[model samples]
Target: MSENRKSKVGSSAAVGNVGKKARNFKPTMKKLISYLSDYKLSLVIVLIFAVVSTIFSIVGPKILGHATTKLFKGVMAKISGTGNIDFNYIGKIILLLVVLYVISALFGYIQGWIMSGISMKVTYKFRKDISEKINRMPLGYFDRTNHGEVLSRVTNDVDTLSQTLNQSLGQIITSVTMVIGVLIMMISISWQMTLVALCVIPVSMGLITVIVKYSQKYFKQQQDYLGHLNGHVEEMYGGHIVMKAFNGEEKSVHKFNKMNGQLFGSAWKSQFLSGIMMPMINFVGNLGYVGICILGGWLAVKRTIEVGDIQAFIQYVRSFTQPISQIANISNILQQTAASAERIFEFLEEEEEIPEVSNPVKLQNVNGSVEFKNVHFGYNTDKIIINDFSASIKPGQRIAIVGPTGAGKTTIIKLLMRFYDINDGSILIDGHDIRDFTRGDLRSIFGMVLQDTWLYNGSIKENIRYGRLDATDEEVVQAAKAAHVDGFVRTLPAGYNMILNEEASNVSQGQKQLLTIARAILANPKILILDEATSSVDTRTELKIQKAMDNLMKDRTSFIIAHRLSTIRDADLILVMDHGDIVEQGNHEELLKKNGIYANLYNSQFEVA
Candidate 1:
C-alpha cells in the first residue's frame, strides 16, 4: 500500500483501540482524583452526609425489629391473660423510624446536589483545559492525528469522566457504607446467622470476579468500536460528495456494516455479562437466606434469638447483598472511567509548541523586510525537505516562488508564518529574529489567502469581519467591494446578511475565494502570502481577483506561490526552485534571457498556454 493509505489505515486501527483498558489504571485514577482536589472541602461534606444518610437507613430495620419484638410479647401476654399490649411503645418506634427515613432522604439529596456541582465544575475545567491545549499544540500533531480522534477526547472521553463522577462517585461511597453498616447490624442480631450470610459472599464474589474478567475485554472492544464507528461515519459524511462521485458507496457500506457487526457483537456480550451479574448474585443471596432461615429457626426454638431478630437479620442480609452487587457493577464502570480519563490526560499532556520568550521584542512598526538566512527545515528532521535554503526580500517587493510539486514551495510560506520553525538559521523581519516575537504578534503581521478557503457558518459580513473582529460594517463592505464580492452578494436575497451553511456550499468556488480575499484585505497586514489565490476562479474572476491582489500588494511585502508562470511575469523577483534548492533566481525577463531552469519552466508553461 501507498504510505498515505497505510497511514490512514493505521490511524483508523488506532482510533478503534483507543478506549482499551488503561495501561496504568492506578496512575490515571490518581490523576483523575487530583481534579477533585480543589473541591476537597465540599467532597468531605458530601462524604459526611453520605455516611450519615447510610447510617440512618441501616439503623432503621434494627430499630423496627424492636417494635416487632414488643408487639409479639404483648400478643403473647394478651392470649395468656397476663397483661395488655404496649400500643404506645409501638407507636413511638414507628414514628422514630419515619423520622430517621426522612432525615436519610434529606441528607442523600444534599450530598447528591453537592457531588453534581463538583462533577460539573471538573467537567468544565477539563473542557477548558482541552481548548487551551489545542491552541498551544503544534500543527504537526493535527497533521499526524485524525480530527475525529481529537474530537472524541473532547466529547466522548470528557463526557465519560463527567458522568462517572456525577453518578458513580456517590454510588461507590453509599454502597461501601451500606455494606459495612448492614454487616454490623447482622452480627448484632446473631453471629451464627451472620456467619451463614457471610458464607455466600465468597461464592458471589468468585462469580463476580469471573464475570468481570471475561466481560472486561468485551467492554473495551465495545467502547473501541463505538469510537471507530463514530469516526468512520464522520469521515464519510465529510467526504460524501467525493465518495459518491468516485462510486465508493458499496465500499463505504461494506466498511460500515463490518464495523457495525463487530460493535453489535461486543455490545451484546458486554451487556449480557453485566446483566447476568445481578441475577447470579441474587441467587447466591437466596441460598444464603435459606441457610440463615434454618439456623435462625433452630436458635428461636431454643429461645436463643427472638422472632423479631430473625426478621431484622433477613433484612440485613438483603441489604448486605445489594450493596455488594452494586459495588461489583461499579467496579466495571470504574474501569471504563479509568480508560476515558487516561485518553483525556494523554491529550492534555502532549508536547506543546516552543514556549514564547519571557521578554519579547515589540516592533514599533513592521517594515515587512523579510530575510531567510541559511534556513534548514523538515517536517521530519532526519529527512530535510529544505536544505540550507537562503533568501532575502526588500520591503514592498512582490517575490514569486515557482516550484514543482514537493519542491518545498508551501513549506517556505509555512516557515515564514512560523507554523513550523526552521531547524537551523534565522528568519528575520526588519532585522529582528521572528523567534524574538510572540507567535501571535508574529502571525498577526501576515495575511494569507490560500487555494483552499476556510469560512465558517456565518453571514457573509460576519465571515468578512473575521479577518479583523473589530472591523466596522462599513469597513467590511469596503473590503467586499475591493475583493469584487459586493456585486455578487447584493444579488442574493439576504445580501451580506445571508447565512452560509456549515460547508459554505451556498457560494460557488470563485465566490468562496473572493470572500477569503476580502477577509485578507480587511486584515491589512504588513506582509501578504498568496498560494494559488486565483487558481479556482474563471478567466473573468481571475482578472478581477488579480486587480484586487495588485492593489492589496502595492505597499506590502508579498510572497506568491504560483504554478502558472504567465501570471507572475511582472513579479519583482521570481525564485525558481527544483528539488529543495532555489536553482535560479531573477526577474522573469532576466531568467528568460538566461535560458536556464527558470527559462525552460517558463517556456513550457508559455507553450502549454
Candidate 2:
C-alpha cells in the first residue's frame, strides 16, 4: 500500500462515497469534457495523426490488389506465349507497401507519445485541484463525511481517469478513422461485396447494446463494493487491538469475509459480461469474412471482379470489423471512466469553508482576554451541541473545564479557536469579534496540545522546528529542556537527530506528548489549550509533563480540559458543564462548597479509590 492509503486507514479516502445522491452521468461527463478544454490543441493534433495513419493503411490493400491483377494478367499471357513475368511491377508494389506501413507506424508512434504527455499533465492538474479543494473545505465536511471516500477519489478514481485518457482516448480516435477509411476502400472495390459484409453490423450493434445495458450496473456496483470492502479492512486494521482485547476477532473475520464475498461477486460479474463482447464480435466478424469470400468467388467466375480485387477487398473488410470490435471495448472502458469521473467532480464541487474576509483585522499585541456571548453552534443544524453558551476570561487566567464525557469541554476550545463559527452571537478575543480577524491571524495567537498526538515522519529536531521555522538549534534545545524532552533525547542513539517513523510510534505515547509540549513552548503563543494532554502517561510521567506545561502556560491565558479532576485544583476558574450549557463557575474551593455537579464529579475520582 502507498503512504497515502496507509494514512487514510480510518477515512473515506480508502473507501469511495460521492456526497449526495449520484448525479446524472451526462452532466458529469460534460463537466469532465470541460477540463479537457485546456488541451484542445493537443487533441486536434492527435486526431490529425490518427486519421492520416489510418488512411495510409486503408490505401495499402488497393495498391497490393493492383500487383495481384498484374501478375494474373501476365501469367495468362505467358501461357498464350505472348508475355513473360514482370518482376519490376511486383518489386515496385512491395516497395510502396513498405513505405505506407512505415509512415503509418511513425504517425501512430507520435500520436501515442503526445497523448501520453497530455494524460499525465491532466492527471497532475486534477490532483493539484483536489489538494487545494480539501484545504478550503470546512472542517465540518470532514466531520460529516467518510475520510476513506475522499482518499479513493484522490487515488483510485484519478488513476482510472488517467488510464482511460492514455489508452481509450487515442483508441477512440484511431478506431473511428480506421472504420471510416476502410469503409470507403471496401465500397470502391466492389459495393455488392461491401453490402454482404455490412449485413452483420446491425446484429453486432444489437448485441453490444443489450450487453452494455446490463453490464453497466454491475460495473457501478463493483466500484461501490470495492470501496465497501476497503472500508472494512481499514477499520479492522486500525482498531485490531481493541477487537482482540474484547475477543471480537471471530466477528471481525466474519465481517471481512462477508464484504469480500460481495466484492468478488460484483467484480467478476462485470468483467465476465464485458469479456463476452470480444468473442461475440469475433464470431460476427468471421461470418462477414465468410460471406465476402463466397461472394467474391462467384463474382470472379463471372469476370465481374479479378482474383486480386477479391483478396484486397477481403483485407479491407477484415480491417473494418477490427476497429468496430476495438470501439466496442473502448466503449466499455469509457463507461467505467465516466463513473470514476463523476465521483471526482462531485468532491471538487462540494461546499467549501466560507472565504476569509478581505482586509480583515490583524492583531498587534494579542493578550488573549477571550469572551463568548450567547454562542450557539452544532456540527449539524438539526441538533445543536453548543447552545447559548457564554464565558469571559481575564488575561493570564487559567480556566479549567470539568465535566463528564459528553459535556462539551473540547467544544469550547474549538469555538475559541474559530475552527467552527457560532450559529448566533460572537466569540471575542482582545475585545474584537474573532471573525474580524483572519483564521491564520486568529490561530497564530494560540497553541494547542490535544488528546491525540500528531508527529510527522521526520527527525526529532525538524519536528520541533515546525513550531518556529527560523528558530536556532540552541532555541530548539532550550524548548526541549523546558518540556523535559531533553532527558529522553539523551538516551536515543541519534539524540535530537533520531528519525520518527511513519506513525511516530518510535517514541512512547507519553514521550510524544512531551515533544508536542516542547513544540508548543517553541511557539510561545499568547494563549494555550490543553485537552487531556497528560492523560496517556503514567502518574510519574504525568506529574513531570504537567510541571512542564505549567511553566509553559505561565502568564498566558490557558483553557485546560482534563477528565482527572485533581489536575485542575489550581485553576483560577472552574466551569462545570452538562450538555451544551455551563451549570456552575468558580474557584475549586468555591465549587466544592456548593456541593453541586462540579463537587460530585471531583469527589467521584476519590470515591473509586
Best by TM-score: 1
lDDT of 2 at 52: 92
Model 2 scores worst on lDDT over the 10 consecutive residues at 1-10
Cα shift from native, residue 533, model 2 (Å): 1.2
What is the Cα-based lDDT of residue 520 in candidate 2? Answer: 86
Error in Å for residue 64 of model 1: 0.8
> Can you write out model 1's per-residue Cα lDDT over 1-609, one digit (the tens) per residue?
111111333235564454355777799889988888999999999999999999999999998889998999999999999987899999999999999999999999999999999999999999999999999998878776766678878888889889998998999999999999999888888988888999998999999899987777776676667767777787888779899999999999998898888889988988899989999999999999899999999999999989889888888888999999999888878877877788799999999999999999899899999998989987778888788888999999999999777787888888889988889999999999999999999999999998888999999999999999999999999999999999999999999999999889999988999999999999998999999888888888888888989999998999998888878988998998876788889998899899997888777876854
Candidate 1, position 530, lDDT: 94
TM-score of 2: 0.94
TM-score of each: 0.96, 0.94
CA lDDT, every model vs. true structure: 0.88, 0.85
Q: What is the lDDT of residue 298 in candidate 2?
A: 95
Per-residue error at 393 for model 2, in Å? 1.3
| Candidate 1 weakest lDDT stretch, 10 residues | 1-10
